[model samples]
Target: MGDTGMPRAFIPRPSPCAPPSPISVFATIDSPPWTLAMSTYGYENCVAGTFYGFTKTEFNPGDTFSLQWGAIDDGATPLNITLGRAGGYIIDEIIVGAQFTKTSALYQLVVDDTANCTLEEFSWAIPDDFNTTDPQYQIGLFNASVLLGADGVPLFGWQAWNPDFYVRPVSSTTTTDASSTTSTVAATATGGNTTTTTSATSLSTFSASPTSSSVSDDSTSNSETIGIGVGVGVGVAALAAVLLGAFYLRRRRKKAQTPSQGLGGVRQQYIQELPATEKRPPMHELAG
Candidate 1:
């Protein structure tokens, strides 16, 4: 028998390992695919590090994955970056590293798909009123949409500790008068005696050498005396005529009655002709 470990026929074919040509190994490691994007703004000159316990591939709640700086204004002054809750970590707080002035700030949210080996990133801006003490600023693993709340739902409840100052509204009134020469006068009168008077004097000449003078006085007094006089002119002829007419009428009546008295017989005849009830009608007849 030939030696057990020895080759029977030494057939040396061309050596396959004769200095293999340089083969470049191209790496095709597929990176995780991005599913969602989240971002924030307003942070400038912030240090780059693992914030909110989020690694380069992890996300946390309330995470500002990416960051951008905004201008200095009454709104959020500093931009913040942190892990988003989409991945699993509940963000309980936010840490702002630097202040920002002028320029928009931006941030992004990123997540890693462990099963599919995919990475997701979403972008967003820090809100205008974003502040550490702002009520809207919340932490913990909560849905962004849910945290923002719906139409009827309440938003965050954190109150800003810093007080904001504002100017108070002012009101004014104005009054104007049209006439310049108009005057207002107020007077009070008291006690027993008070007098008010107005006076005016004037002179006029209708012809040469004409002269005129006048005086007027109005007075009030406690006691006053007034005198009145009447003058009568007597006429002897008028008086005598009235007396003579009176005397004539008396004489005529006397003469007429004398005849009547002397003629008693005629009188008696006239009287006998008269009726006893002639002077008055009977009571029943008078009533009718």
Candidate 2:
């Protein structure tokens, strides 16, 4: 199997930690298939960038089959490989010297340990006629993770792109049409808090734009309230100081003024008046 390009036939092995549980995420058609050629890999109608290789393009009901590949970073850095809902095993980037040996980090998914090479199969069997009413009718693989930064900003891992293979009626629908949903999670870290969101929506030319004006408005309102509170406190303090100064000046002026007494009331004579009855007459007579 290593020499040839084909994978060897073997029983599906269980994961060491835990088997990937089948999730309800469905496959979506990002762009029209015309943009992506049958022979070449194109980024035409894809929402998130991915490299895919599957055994068959079309399948039927009750068919036992599998889609296998590795999760490569089309954009996000530190590319991580998760089993996801596709129920695949983790493997190391292989490098084999053979005519048809697939030796790419982003190509075929395989095991790192040669001793445990047999545990590298991502297999799934198709169910009978699927219920038409159910929106999630197709099965797919997803590479998803949320990265939190110290600034409360969120970075994403491999984006939730469409899977390699989708199970659907061949004639009824030529292209896969999967519905996408967004889930928001509140995440708190040691330094700051962040809001993590996982969305499967395709990145189209006319993708929906979110409104951040509400958050801005709330922040603005809070700032205004704080400013008003501070202004009011300062004004009140200034007014109290002015009132206290005015009262103190009035009390000092009242104390400085001398009190006067009526004729019947006894008052302290600061200066005693001597007998001045003959003084003016004697001066006038002597001058004459």
Candidate 3:
């Protein structure tokens, strides 16, 4: 995709009454259609919505980025599966990560393990034909894929579509003339926890840590820039220990609720989108 602007993402936040906790960009592991979540103040259950968590709000077509999350499957294992179909949709553009796999018109990613709840990340490349100029045309994943199947066909509750995502408007005089685009994104801090550094590069920068997400057209390579602050010190021992205790405490809240039946027995998920306009999100205090 040509330079439209930096890709943007959005996500949900914890309640104000919640305590200071490690923040993470994660997808919930539940029934077929899972939800994306992030924790800032404290731990909470997933909230279904028109838009889930994202570091940026709008992503430029061809912009490659990652979606990482920690989810526990108290309901059933989230297996990544794709149906034999004709063409590709927005969700099909996924390059596939971890449990993720894709065909021409279909893809599936189950970042969450069958049980362990830590972090798993993957990179996604938006196709050039994608809609970036219109929010109505903005693609949605997870909760909003009700009316879509592989290749945008009619499916009940699979990774069919996306929402609240957009493409940035290119400054006509600027984008075409420049060989590379340099843009600075301002960060919005909530509860004084999330902090993001504003930077820019020629290609476009996308990275994820335990804490927050920052996008800059600022890095030379997208893969090289990921996990920038994710230190090596978070050894398996530490993560395993923390997850053990955190798992039990969080597992009690793991019951799943099927989305109410829509017309023709299709599972339709009604959602209330939480504000994710804030730029970077912090990992849990323990994540540090």
True-vs-predicted CA distance for residue 115, candidate 3, Å:
14
> Which regions of candidate 2 are displaced past 4 Å?
1-211, 258-288
Q: Which ten residues in a row have the lowest lDDT in candidate 2?
A: 92-101
Q: Candidate 3: what lDDT? A: 0.35
lDDT of 3 at 280: 78
lDDT per residue (tens digit) for residues 1-288 in model 3:
122222222223234354323221222232232322222222134322212345575556555543433332321222222212223223331211223332111123333333323332234455556544443333333322122232333432333333344554444334643543322222233222333333322113443431233334334346555654345445666888898989876765553322332432442222334454777788667754
lDDT of 2: 0.35
How far off is residue 164 in model 2, in Å?
24
Q: All predictions: root-mean-square deviation over Cα?
A: 35.8, 22.0, 48.6
Better of 2 and 3 by TM-score: 3
Mind sharing the TM-score for model 3?
Answer: 0.27
What C-alpha lDDT values do all the predictions have? 0.28, 0.35, 0.35
lDDT of 2 by residue, 1-288 (tens): 012222222223234244233231222122332322222232133322333354465555555544333323332222223322232322211111101112322222333332322111233344465332322222322222222111232212223323544445545553332211112212222122322221222333225433356668889999999999999999999999999999999998877663443432433342344444554534455664
- 32-125 in candidate 1: lDDT tens per residue? 3232222323223322221221323322233333321112222222222222222222233233222321221211223222321111121332
**All candidates' TM-scores?**
0.14, 0.24, 0.27
